[model samples]
Target: MSAGLLATSPGGDVLVAAIVVPVIGILLLWLVRPRAVEWVALAALLANLGVAVAVLRTVSSSAAPVAYLIGGWQPPLGLALRADGIAAVFMAMAATVLVPVAIYARGAFGAPGERRPMVFWTMLLAITAALNLIFCGQDLFNLYVALELLTFAAVPLVSLDGSRETLKAALRYLVFALAGSVLYLLGVAIIYGAYGTLDLIGLASIRGPDGALLLAIGVMTAGLAAKTALFPLHLWLPPAHAGAPPAASAVLSALVVKGSFFIALRLWFDLLPPERAVAGSTLLGVFGAAAVIIGSAMALRQARLKLLVAYSTVAQLGYLFLVFPLGLGSGAAPFESTAWTAGALQLMAHAFAKAAMFMAAGLVYEAIGHDRIAEFRGLGRIAPLTVLTMTLASISLMGLPPSGGFSAKWLMLTAAFGEGAWWWVLVIAAGGLLAAGYVFRILVPAFTPPEEPIARVKPVVVRREAAALALAVIAILIGFLPLAPWPLLAIGRIAAGAP
Candidate 1:
């Protein structure tokens, strides 16, 4: 991307507000009665959505980055916040998934004043704030802080129920995260020592494929891959996500994992020079392909419903890594390429579909008191709404027509073939077929009639059901985006020196 394309612009304060609004709520939560937290958090998220939309409108209209130089100082001296078209899109994604999860949680967690409910609400809003910063942050160190905030907030929600088992899962999650943090910090130290500044744009200005720089990239990528759970490093995710309450699980699967993945994107596509990126990108794609094949098989082996969804996440996240290789194949600038747009659509589609699926799984747990797939017979009849939600969400995951997943896969397939990357095409097709197999594993048995009237494990909340369904609908609706290389994705992307 051209250095001339990015600069501080009007509506910069909106970028500040996008991060500060939820931090204000986090602070005020202690002063308010616990019951008021939900109302306050919900209102804040709604307001944040409005601000995010305005930022999106501003960037779209200007066709450039909306940037803020913190304290009137530029990089190497002060921090920055910037929203490109991609950032705006992700901010919108966070709001869409989060507000609905908030609504669903009101019923899932019961009375608001309770400690668990209060904690969950505060953390949920905190996650919204942290993820926003992750998307918009321009300083590497500043982004690290936001990532830690996301990690800490997310860890608590994993063990929200306070079960001994959940506590253990949370502990395991924390330990792995802390280990990843150490590696990430080490990489940060290396970069700072080598370059004397940690701003992304600054690094981009001076980046080269030196040994020091490559070492930093290697260590940092390892750390991030751990957090994003791209493959073998995913040991902690299934337990943590599966154990959390439904709403929390939705946020974790849908948005939290994407936070680290987003930073990885920044590193490879935005910060790293092309010559340096190719080898690393291909390595990531290899890991991704491995994840899709192995993770899907693991998912098929799961007997429980939520575990299947969790392992499927392991597979779905792998698809994102394939972008690195696909983007590199055609000598096309990655930021402006079909592969880039395809990957971004995949990210958004999975967010909506996975959130809905996790929530629906939670409801299934609520309806059946057990997530064992064997006992799931007749659930479609007993909780038609939840089952319907799962089915629709699955359609997106399976990459079927009239859904965003299909659109993403279709574009990626085109890119693969255009680049003559037939190997990747096979991986994509195999991954989709495996995805269908796992999805059917759940849905087919769900169509069976139970031996007797299914017992309701808990009271059914119509609003809760609706919230999950809304996310599923959003996934389907994203398929409506034009099925071609998207110029919208390039609205604020810097690719050439003023073309």
Candidate 2:
């Protein structure tokens, strides 16, 4: 055992609270009145958000990982939950996004004693607990369990309305996710058989280009790609996200897919040697480039607002995988490179922007009674705040200046220039143009003048509008980050060899 890896840090108990508080809220839901479900869920999530921020602060100040070993046992014999810099960032991002989502959902799921509200709140809490595990898990088997919990929690939200189309979509999502799980588990088994240890730090110390290790990584990456809905394994995402309730769509799109993607990052950068994975990293980049092009084209063709947003998610996710090739190919510690910072910024930016966009879509549907893009003429007049939310989010999604998307792409472009990787440069530029095309498709019709005045079917609450807009503004605020490699991201990264 690496002695450095076994010691728990001060304030490490916050990690335990991050997972436990939400679980407690899940249990409290049944005991509270139906109307109190929203209160219980919100209180727990708020507390969880504070915990996430505390973890980030501790890691930032200490410049090291914060860890808590379960039962004081070491890895391979017992489990450890560790929060490295990247994990702290992911946790903080997830918590920040979840709070706004919970607030926005109150308008829809806050009614007293309703079955749907109960189910939604319960699943929301379940997802919170599962995501905490995913960020803190230190071994493959534990990560697999967290992934399964996230999948199960998210699937019910997809079919919450119980419509025939949604049920079918939910089933498809579940099946594909389970298939991914099987492959992941198989990889974990192979790793244990070959290395006799599953702890990430332990694996990193011994990782090599051994055939068994290579095979395990291949299968595991394939599985995580399916779970993350990376094209061409992305068929399940559009239907599932588009058909769900808007609040659910926000969570599914912004955070759930990221859980799997985070594990993929750990696998490729932590458990595999970067210098040796050149070919594999490039292959992953190729798929990401394909996802950017094809996913954007599909989004441009979607007739409904929600479906357009869903496909946009598929396109946005492609940028993340590009970091693998850009960082690993740079001939530097992947975690210390600008590409790595760009990828983290991209993830945070997309979470806030996409969540806001989905909430706006739901509000649009509520006002106009339909989400058909063509029928959105005069949307600005009927629901100006919702339209404003969409516009602000689009600014980020289109990679415009003074927004998170812009900073991420700018850093990525700089990294590509440094490496003289012109092919990737072209892909990044083209992806931005295509993103602009789809964003305009939504904005143009919404701003168009109606032959006659359009009336709202239902009134939109100011609280919900503020909630969505707050998320969008945060996406923009992230642009203020210096367009360079972040030192915080480097903390504890070398210990596990994670980029």
Number of backbone collisions per candidate? 1, 0
TM-score of 1: 0.97
- The candidate maximizing lDDT is 2
lDDT of 2 at 365: 92
Alpha-carbon runs more than 4 Å astray in model 1: 1-7, 494-499
| lDDT of each residue in 72-171, candidate 2, tens digit only | 8888788889998999999999999999999999959545798899989899999999999999999889999999999999999999999999999999
Could you estimate the TM-score for every candidate? 0.97, 0.98
Error of 1 at 90 (Å): 0.7
User: What is the model-wide C-alpha lDDT for candidate 2?
Assistant: 0.91
lDDT of 1 by residue, 1-499 (tens): 5552245688888999999988887877777887677788888888888888888889888887789887888777888888888998888888878888888887467676787887888898889899999989988889888889999999999999999988998999888887877788888999999999888777777777688888987898899999999888989999998999989999999999999999888777776667677788888999999998888999999999988999999999999999999986669777678899999999999999999999999889888899999888898888899999999999999999999999999999999999998988999999999999999999998988888878888867889999999999999999998998776676655333322
